[model samples]
Target chain A: MDEKQFRDYLSSYTDAEKALSAPMRDTIRINTLKIPKKEFMGVSGLKMEPTFYENGFYADAGPGVRLGATWEYFLGYMHTQTLSSMAPALVLNPGERDIVLDAAASPGSKTSHMSMLMNNKGAILANDVNWERGSALFSNIARLGVLNAKVTVRDATRLGINAYFTKALVDAPCSSLSQPYAYKKFTPNLSYEISKTQIKMLFSSYDALAEGGELVYSTCTYEKGENEEAIKLLLEKRGSASLQPLGVEFPHEPGLSEYGKEFRKVARVYPQHFSSEGFFIAKLKKGSA
Target chain B: MSHVTTFREYLQRQFGAEVPKEIVLNEQEGVIRAYSKTLMMLKPSGYMGFVAGKVSTRGIEVKSEFAQLLRNPSRNVLALDEAQAKAFVESESVAIAEQGEGLRIAKFGRHVLGVGILKAGSLHPDFIGKGRKRVENSINP
Candidate 1:
């Protein structure tokens, strides 16, 4: 979509077009499993302020200071992630003793965060279809001292594992609409194909979830087809599943209700609202299958 | 039986520590992996991979990625000063004030970076690799 067309499409939401061009913020999450929040903040030299997420902080790193090179980072005490990217895991909110599945974990930003949240207590099946990405995920899991994670390379939609998980995160692959620089190349066909795959992945994730378990489906794109429409399709197919509100406080708009009432309860983070990347998150609860 | 005993003995000799009872040490082909019962259950079918580290003639040489999982601080651990810690992360060898023998876990403050070999007064931060460099860039940049 062109700038004008995109603006017209999101006419209902103020600043949606302007937010697309705004500079993104750099945010980091402290790995509480490895280090306490206060201790990590004391040692990290960067100027930072806490985000809505308790462990997350927006960092104003100076030109010479590389947040990734710090000793704390080497110790897996912190991860440089976008504030929006950190939401799905928090929304999923897997307990310390719950077995969780990271459906599309790669390079493991969310997987490692989930591991930290679980305090490395329960097992996490971190799977990715690509071999190269899977290796990156394994390395990150190891570097971050995530002992509870088991790496696997397989198509998430076709994963043959029979074991049911208490929680699951489907950070579906989508068009790079949220990426500030990728707006020029956005196309309708690409969005449709990604939406189809996302719906398939969601169905598989729901099947893997234990009855009465919860799952969070998220995408970085703001495209309604990839976000709200995909969730609507899943809800249609799986009658036992229903959307749940994400009870966290952050700057966000409700998911587009035109798709469904459940979508209205879902959450969307626009860049204009928080100086972060655009993201969509919908929490689903599975009833008896 | 003898091989298992030798491996156990090597673990004790190298780190001056004993493996936790919950962790089972298994040898496949030539690599040795330490897996808890929970980890074994979580393993995917047809998956052949190491959970802990590989067993080598030198000792049970832990993978760099698995280095942080080692909690037992032994004589093998070499705590570096601020300057040496910076250099060690840059993949540079630094001189230690006091010399230690054998493989050492290179630590900065309370955090373990990875393993290194100390001979004489010089410490070779061989464990510093892509992961370390990535960490270094995040801090130094």
Candidate 2:
């Protein structure tokens, strides 16, 4: 809120930790499914670097070019996303025809990434509580050339669909405290007391997941209440789901706070610490439904 | 792709505005589909799913929001009567309406479709499917 309050809230994090809060330059990944990478390079005058463990490319452009208005973007060859943000969907490791759930998916960046990872073979249910965002989600799905997903506008808690998913991404909305680093208008104070809703949303999302399914609980906030605490609460409620250690060379060191004794296995990411946004990703496997 | 190219050419010949270069076209069955965003821009990829098929001369299948634009092309000026609305929908004539924000056109389609444009001068995104039936049903029912 104010400068002193912002510093007090950020007091727990060191200067290096505070640096991770800055947002990286806007980057987009070029999808090769519809159009080749070369065509995208030619049209946008942007070069590409290989993505982390995916076929998509990392571009050196910003969103100002109206990339979406171009015929190339409309053709589904390119998608605007961040480098670090794309990790959760790839980590889910969904198989063909496996149903998936993207809880709190809006302005869908990760949900579409998951579909491309699945090669658009199976069904993905992208649910968001906000009705205003429902159509925008649909518009993105259609534009990306993804055929396997279905859109549903319902509160995250009322997601009583009969289908069971092999994987789910609960990218719950957090305090968005990490946004300040990415954009000037955002600050650490943004997430304070704002994560309570996200905790409730994540709890409802876990209820919709299935046995033997993998769930990647993620948030972009630096707060313990929304991150590990929420996962800890859900694990306690659903007793069958357990935290699985992440093996990937994640960009940050672990969080000092533990949601539960079992969540010691949880993996935490900080933007200043990880060269990306302040993110927390905890992988949970449903041993029983 | 063939059908999409053909359809694009036809639309360009009919309507002077050459469909922007980056909008991708997909053809499946007899319909032609156009999209404004890319696969990656789609966050929740399955959120809205995919288009049912291609756009046909009979009628194009669009989302409800897009359909609203096709039904009432006039931005804020509600036509005097159904006849005016019908004329707007039946003819692709662009009637400029200075509404709340700025100037936008009211476009008419084959069926009694009308749509309001914001500052962008582009059709609303979800203008597809049985927009006429929905608009009329909203009035009658």
Candidate 3:
């Protein structure tokens, strides 16, 4: 692989490299399932500024407050998550009546967020392929008071539940190159290799999705193969898959547009744009071919 | 439904709450759990659900997992001030005046901390939570 060419892709966006190493404030979301927003804020006794996302705030814990060890956290009143990571679920927008599939849910930040979005009224099939990670997923799910999810431990690509989910989320694990010094952990050789497995997860997400159902494919990496090209391949093989505009009103650039291909509907959030990690999000609809 | 009937009778008799009509209650090996009824249609695995309580000859002993779900119960509650609540989570037992025979839900102000035992007016914390690791009970940013 042309490692230099792959690294050069960041030149397409402003401050992409600078954004990579930016330090960000601790951001947390009030778990409204456990406590109301206003009530949480009142009891938190910490100074906080609201972020762009709903029920999210950029928190300043001051001197002694360990957000993780606090009674509020233990009681499932709040969760720590990045602003960029929170967008995919907001765009997916699983409602109170939707049967959603969180295809790669673990440590369950998105799954718990989806439950909060649903007001804990809908069903979520939260699955992760690894048993080890699945335990952490349930821990978060339990800690957040998420009663609407059915946790499953299985190979996501082998999941053959067809047309059962009204909406599905595939927050596929990537090289995490968006983080500062993350490239040292994952070499460039793994870019396409990782996307290969990502495509399988996508196929499973598409399969489980009901026709005309919304699918949100997201990754924290900026690899084109994992980002745009994989979706391009999916549209080619599965003729019913079509990209839809992601309705996130945040600081982000549109998906890479090159050659004669048009990927204008997809969105890429640069870390510098929002002082959060980089993310690539695409909204798609599954339909009958 | 006779699913965990004893647990059901215990909840109603103790908290004056019916475990919410929308929740599905299940018991296995004497431990009662609760989950969203709609999600169970998927026949989910790892539905350990929330560990509401365990059933025995004395009826049900509430688990800390069910503390937040209860608003306020009419009977069998052990109230603690902020200082005692902090000390209790660290596996400390506080002396008391009222002689309750068994366990009661421990509360700090409006927040329900977990289950505690009251024997001969000595309140013992039976917490199954982060405090088990000797956590710094401060609210960190």
Stretches of model 1 off by over 4 angstroms after superposition? A1-14, A21-23, A161-163, B1-11, B17-37, B46-51, B97-101, B119-121, B128-141
TM-score of chain A of each: 0.93, 0.83, 0.93
Against the true two-chain complex, what DockQ does each candidate achieve? 0.37, 0.11, 0.42
* Candidate 1 per-residue C-alpha lDDT over A1-289 given as tens digits, one digit per residue, 9 for 90 to 100: 7777776655665466567566788889888866788787777777788778888888866776677766666667788899998998988887767878888998899988987787776778888888887767766665666666777777887766553888899999998677754656778888888888888888888898888889999998878888888788878888888998897778888987577565777998888777788898999999954
Across residues A1-289, which tens digit of lDDT does each residue of candidate 3 receive?
2335435656655454566456766778889998898788777765678788868788766677666656676678888888888999999999998988899999899999999999887789888988888767867876787888877787887787888888999999898878766766665578878888999999988988888899999999887888888788888998889888787687787887682245778888886676788899999999843
> What local lDDT score does residue A205 receive in model 2, on the 0 to 100 scale?
68
TM-scores of the candidates in the order shown:
0.88, 0.64, 0.89
Residue B100 in candidate 3 has what lDDT?
56
Write model 2 residue lDDT over A115-180, tens digit each, in one string: 777766666777788878766676666556555566667777556643366678888876666666
Assess candidate 2 and give its lDDT.
Answer: 0.56
- Which scores greater on TM-score, model 1 or model 3? 3
Top TM-score: which candidate number?
Answer: 3
In terms of lDDT, which candidate is strongest? 3
Tens digit per residue, CA lDDT, model 1, B1-141 = 555566667656776656656546666557665444455556454222234555555655655545565557585777776777778777777788775566677877676667676778877765423543734433321
What is residue B71's positional error in candidate 1, in angstroms?
Answer: 3.6
